[model samples]
Target: TTDSGVGSTPAAEAVAQRLRAAGFPEADIQVIGPSARKKNVVARLHGSGKAKPILIFGHLDVVEAPKEDWSPDLDPFKFVERDGYFYGRGTQDMKGAAAIVVTNFIRWKQEGWVPARDLVLALTADEELYGDEDGVDWLLKNHRDLIDAEYSLNSDGGDFQTRDRKPYSIAVAAGEKKETILQLVTHNRGGHGSQPRKDNAIYQLNAALDRIAKLRFPVVLNDVTRAQFDALSALESGQVAADMKAVSRDPPDAAAVERLSEDPYYNALLRTTCVATMLEAGHGPSALPQRAKAVINCRIAPGHTSAEMLQTLRETIADDGVEIAWQFNEPSDPPASPLRPEVFAAVRKATDRMWQGVVLMPGMETGMTDARFLRAAGIPSYGVSGTFLEQGDGRAHGKDERIRVSDFYAGVEFYDRFMKALAGG
Candidate 1:
């Protein structure tokens, strides 16, 4: 379901109404939001009261997709299956996973299966884009007890990479980089189109961006990345694997780091990354721009604070005229989740049952997720998805977003077993 109301209120409340119709108690299900348009839905399946609740969360929001950008005959809002893939806006991004979680919850209830502890299914809103109305943030700030759990399984993490439709490994997102958005504004005196000025706001902004484009942050590694490289070694071969291993070292190989730094994907994994996403200058094309503003989006690595990244950015820009400021309030640094043995064991058990010989690696997502907020709030949040997407098959937030039909069903089966293992069923 799409959150047409901008927040999840319309869609989430729809799901809650379905849960209520399916015999869920009123007290066990809650739809709360700061606004009526944006709501977070929570449903609890009570157990024998032996253990703390386990949270399974997925956002109900999808990134906006313009109709003109999509392929012919493909409406982003409509589900269409072709060529063994289900095409839709949220197909791969996560509405598919949310449906899986809700389906399982209903199945367990229908089968009269009781677990050792409560299982909370949280379908939240406003995760695609950030705002004060973030569903996860709102829930934690207001009704923390309704959805509080020892740990959470976030479906909005990373893709489960596969090769030739065969599962090679599942990258369990153990940690994620935090977001730091900065606004770079350059000011100049407005002038008529006929009168050319040397001090152009747009030119200064472009120059600053050019410097940022060439600049690279120093490579850094944490437990999650180190373990990721160690696991990745088995999947990769030759120098690439060797370079990965070397770069992951406590004292990383300088040559290997230098070589890997040339690659964007690998570079993002090794260090914090910032890029100019949006730019605006002048009111009209004929007018001399009085002010130019560019938005720089940074994914700060774990163990680094946003303030530190901002300071580094300021130094990199170094232009006195380019005034830099944080787009959002200063962010609190969230620590990486530890590799708990029990958690790994549980993943292994489920993976073995689903795709035997498939590896499960502790991966750190390059993009930020609500998991960071949960982790900052002292909950061990993990990005775990059973859905396996082939290499180069990821289509989240892109035109004609789709997921393999087989992979979708496989995910359904995997979560059924996974939840049982986690809840001691």
Candidate 2:
């Protein structure tokens, strides 16, 4: 297990010991790098040599949750059970998944069910704050042999019944957007606050922001996203379904794109998006600034490049004085794991066994995950956590995060069957 934010070392060590006590071999389990309290724990259960190994991945780190904002009786780290839900910071996003993986490992060992392939569980850290230190990035760079596998199931996809309690849930997630951070700077001659200048850096920076906010990039749909919308539309009713069907049949219409973009979820799938997250200007409140800067977080859609997005920004801002600098760039294309018949069949069979014939659709994730790294390694990867949830729970990365205990155990069953089916056990 790993920890996400400040003070993750203790939590990571605690979870490691728990795994050891639960019958994981001490030599096979290794905790690496809790730099800034970030750490990743890896364990494996060797299988009969019937199929290639599968990697089961989950993040141990979580974003910050303040004690005051939570319920008075709630503790972020304390696992609580109420209303069939297991509540805690990492419940959904996703210590629960890690627990499921660990439990299954033990169960498989106890049952002596040596199936087709080996299973590697990588509970990683620093996934919440970018994967620089103890997360997938570090693993891929430093310890590839330990967790390398034929395919990977990165935690973060599954079906959740909507707020209205729909009977079906979507089982999908294939590709993800590439994350890029850019800094925009506007500079001007320093002057006293008492004497205002029209071309002051602050004014220029605000103007650039205004232009960025108003401009909308053209929509470009890839195969994965198109498939996702089609499957989702098939499951819905009313105009939403109709809109999705229309777009699925033809290319993304300007009108439809405009409408869908208004919804935060659909907007991300359609095109690259930029959000200005941080701003700084002037040395002090009383001083006039010589320079102003803003940090823009851009998620480049598949088929888009950072260079192209940067060029688009330059054109949109249209100010020679405003300069842009790249803070970080990890250019990625959608992972090339084909929605092949065999792979799809495996997922479908698993879903049918678990959910009694629920529709399984292919989806592209808006947020990035470690699948990108595995894909880069020429390994096929998919996000296929079998746990289902109720929509609008606002649990992931939010306060009062929880997952149904039954659902957690169900995921274990699904994954066990999935591995067996995939490796031909």
Candidate 3:
């Protein structure tokens, strides 16, 4: 709903104002940022100093949505409650979870409750922008003490995935893949449409893209994914379950990998993924292109480096004509957050109370998040929230973004339980 880069400051200020109204001192509730538009709100609920603070945070920004792009019955900017669902840009991607966390923190304060440790809530800005300068990274760099914590739970992490409208898994994102953007370029002399040649620039570019389309990086299981599948194996029954168990082992079953790779989400969890996104070719419709370029975005697995991916691309294309180069805005290559037993235990206690028998999944994010920066700064971050989304109907960053109204309230209640469990109110 809000403009992509220019954060809705009124929203951030409103959150800070709410904390103050709820008896949070002015000193503990702050709206800080580089400018008026791009701001972050951080609030604290004091606790007994029995343990270091734990942060629960999320960004205020959502991906840009144009009104014309949404369905005829919906508006991108406005929040609507209809048919047991709340419709808006950020309802699914985050803001719903943000609201839940803030409510829980305020509830604790009003009840005169004290936790075993401080609970820091950092509602930040500009996370949708890759390599953003004013969000979580900015807070950690410029004002570490305000939001520093022993560990963090990012509301950006999704929870409670459903299959056939049945709740099945509670995913705790313990790790995420770093991203590297690469541009594949092909250049040749311009010519008239009538004078086609085998070494045409456009043709060369297409061939390189075609090769990448069929390429699948070999499966490499990091600790998070390995544990994730191990749990899934017990929860699922059939060939998929066997594959999950097989892939987590030291010598991963190639046949099992092939079977699981049929699903895009599972495939992404198993290895790095590179696919062409943007393309630029001929200057005119009928003209032979003098220069053609295609951009490929790669979500790299935990252990691999961008340099290594670049080499992999070059080797795959196997063509001297293609000049592949790694693009800028490189993401942080931090190690995965160690799967601490305490965090999982807390998550399990809360999840089992709500969605009993649901799988407790310690998964990896195939997509990137600001957690990379936090992980780089030695603040272990996990993506945990009570918001549930349908498996295939996750419309985040897409048209008609919405969340089930019942699920939203359930999330509010779940956060209440989770916060109490983790901090011991």
Give TM per candidate: 0.93, 0.89, 0.95
What is the C-alpha lDDT profile of model 2 across 1-425, one tens digit per residue?
33323545555577678767767788878788637477778877777785667888877777787777788899877789998889988888877776776677667767667666787888777777664556787888889888888788876554445344333765467677888888999887787778776778899999999999987777867677777788888677887887776666556666667777789888888888998999999986766788899999888886787888999999999999999999988745654366656666887788777665365677777777777777877777778766677776758877788887777777788777776687654
lDDT of 3 by residue, 21-61 (tens): 88999999889988789889999999987678999899888
lDDT by candidate, in order shown: 0.84, 0.75, 0.86
lDDT of 3 at 298: 91
Q: After superposing candidate 3, which stretches have Cα over 4 Å from the reference?
A: 4-6, 163-166
Runs of candidate 1 exceeding 4 Å displacement: 1-7, 132-134, 190-199, 282-289
lDDT of 1 at 120: 91
Against the hidden true structure, what lDDT does model 3 obtain?
Answer: 0.86
Question: So what's the TM-score on candidate 2?
Answer: 0.89
- Let me know the TM-score candidate 1 reaches against the reference structure: 0.93
Best by lDDT: 3
Evaluation by TM-score, superior candidate among 1 and 3:
3
lDDT tens readout by residue for model 1, 223-247: 9999898888888899888998897
Model 2: number of clashes?
A: 2
